[model samples]
Target: MNQTIVPDSQARGLLARLPATPRALALLARFDRPIGWWLLFWPGAWAVALAGGGVVRWALIGWLLLGAIAMRGAGCVFNDIVDRDLDAKVARTAARPLASGAMAVKVAWAWLLALCLIGLIVLLQLHLYAQVVALASLALVAAYPFMKRITGWPQIWLGLVFSWAALVGWSEVAGSLTLPGLLLYAGTIFWVVGYDTIYAMQDREDDALIGIGSSALSMGRHVRMGVMLCYLAALGLWGGALWVVRPQILALAALLPIAVHLGWQVITLKEDGIDPLAKFRSNRFAGLLVFCACIVVGNA
Candidate 1:
């Protein structure tokens, strides 16, 4: 029988040189996919940039990137553990380490703990207020894996969890969460929903067969419209965030580039094959555009 590789696995080059045990563990944490960490890191960076910490808080951005990498790995490990059975039933996921029995649950839990330890170190680097804000996201993270089983809009719950770094980044720099921070967080939630829906397109048939829910499945033929609305809401909220900080007309224009990029994604989106995956990965670039916008608006 041929080995089925997970379609999105980027485990090659240096990562491919690791031994079987380590490779399986790395894949379990999704270290093979750098895009996940990039997506997870961008929101915090954007918040810090928008809050006017673009220069002075450079070290904080680095620490947040560390935290994002660790925490996102931990989350992926936890999610794979919880979804192992479900994953086994999905063709796209059936090759995952946990689903394929390449890694034991106990070992995955151990790796999860190791990653969380790294996250804890990064969390300690923040001030008391920001630390508290960061801790508050634990509940959201803990509940995320089960969202698919119980709700059609699991992406919304994911939005809440994934976009949480906005609050952390803003509070760490500004010493409190304010309207601008809240708006950035809200906009990031919509962005997460939009892109994650695209990612879910790869699993629609398997997800339906397995009786799980996803935004892609929920929207059906209207998926493009759904993503467009989500992108529009994100741009509007982000514009509000920038305006709250600078309160000038040009501040809003900071969002124009990202708006156009998102528009391009929607305009060219294809619901099948590699198009969805390509568009989903393109958000890494999208995140950079937003970060540049934030820096421009906040520093002006």
Candidate 2:
């Protein structure tokens, strides 16, 4: 009998079309789900672009992008290894390589190691200070998979992990963390919280049944307002970050476009079916809009 892949499979994109063997490995790394890596890469890009990289920082941006994809893939593989049972229980994740027994645990470990090696190569491309800052996230990354089992607001932990690139990116350019860098990190945390909550909405029912916890369940009927607050806080902090970089009144306005995009997500979001996932994925563009804002502020 064929496996039941569930509704979220539409988001699988090209991964769903591959032959079963390689597809499982691709799914394990979430290669088909470019949005995850894009979202992960953006904060770093925003930081670099904000530092006025222009043509000079293009190579650094490329390295950061490679690091994002590799490390994000490694993180997913590690998360799956830890959450295999949980993923099997969740309808949306039931067909994942590890969850469905399509990939062996030993093989997953090898694949994870391979991905981490790529991340290590990218890490070497960073400066000494940036390298240390990047390595500091290892402990946080190791702890993330267990957050959901222990806390109602696991997305908060995820925010810490996902937004870590701000430190790395800024350090790569500035030699250490700065006022703008810290604010950028803090702002990206709120953005992650908002979007991951939206993504969590898809598994609300299954998560509840499986005795799991998430921000979506914690927020309950106040989901829209909760996301709005997260976005608002993100814009406020990010706006401040920009202000510190270049203290122009108009510098603050750079965030307006993405703020509007985030607002659209909140306004159009429905708690049912794919609305949440669609809103979640739309964040890739949201991230880009903010990067553009950073370019304007940092370069101008």
Candidate 3:
């Protein structure tokens, strides 16, 4: 009896050799973008930490993580599918799987359904109140794609959709909503608006050409100042949330790092640079920094 052991590299190679379309489909789901998952996970984590220090609910965290990945992907895919035609017209989005025709609409829809099913499983794990909070986000999610077509401030809509997890997270842990949770949700919204505006700057030219609306285009030459003000608003709301939760000076102090990070991002941002995408991606770290502040204050 001969037994063979496969090396890790060889196993990976074999897997890589398999048909890659499904893998590509997963990528289109934004599985590759950990930023989305992180953004979704932090709010829930903050709520759990701030809910007076019970045993950290690892199972709930795990479920929320899974839900975030699935739902964020579903949202992105839906956005891409809806904007497939418009995406093809934009330089930055032209190579997207849907826009490039690498994936069929039917196939994308199937993938969307699969992701939504995963989200449903996660939702079922939540308390009834949390479930209701989660379900209420459906309208925001459904309407998000159309905002860029109709309004120059679609970042505001994205804020509402993306930061909704703050509410869900708080409700999950506390079994009810509070002023702190609502303020955190609002703060997260402004943060999303600020960072996403930075993300949108990369496409300002294409957006202008294609007649798509974004804060980037709306602010135009004043983009930097606009982003700065948005960042300030985020900080203010976050500070307010901290005050409501802990009412401590340390909570306010914890915000200093995040404030500096936001300042650095705005001061160093180069809208005309050759690598706006890299700059935009850096906001993942910014989000992480702010989240760290939230966790520190919440856990303290």
Please report the candidate that would top TM-score against the real structure: 1
Order of models, best lDDT first: 1, 2, 3
Measured with C-alpha atoms, the lDDT of residue 160 in candidate 3 is 93
Q: How many residue pairs clash in each candidate?
A: 0, 0, 0
* Candidate 3 C-alpha lDDT tens digits along 108-147: 9999999999999999999899999999999999999999
1-300 per-residue lDDT for model 1 (tens digits): 222347787767756688788878788888888899999999999999988899888999999999999999999999999999999898888888889888889999999999999999999999999999999999999999999999999999999999999999999988899999999999999999999999999999989998999999999999999999999999999999998899998898888899999999999998787899999999999999999999988788
Best by lDDT: 1
Checking candidate 2 for backbone clashes, the offending pairs are: none
lDDT score at residue 80, model 1, on the 0-100 scale: 96
Residue pairs with backbone overlap in model 3? none
Global lDDT for candidate 1?
0.92
For model 1, the run of ten residues with the poorest summed lDDT? 1-10
Query: What does candidate 3 score on TM?
Result: 0.90
Compared with the true structure, all predictions reach lDDT values of 0.92, 0.90, 0.79
* Candidate 2 lDDT: 0.90
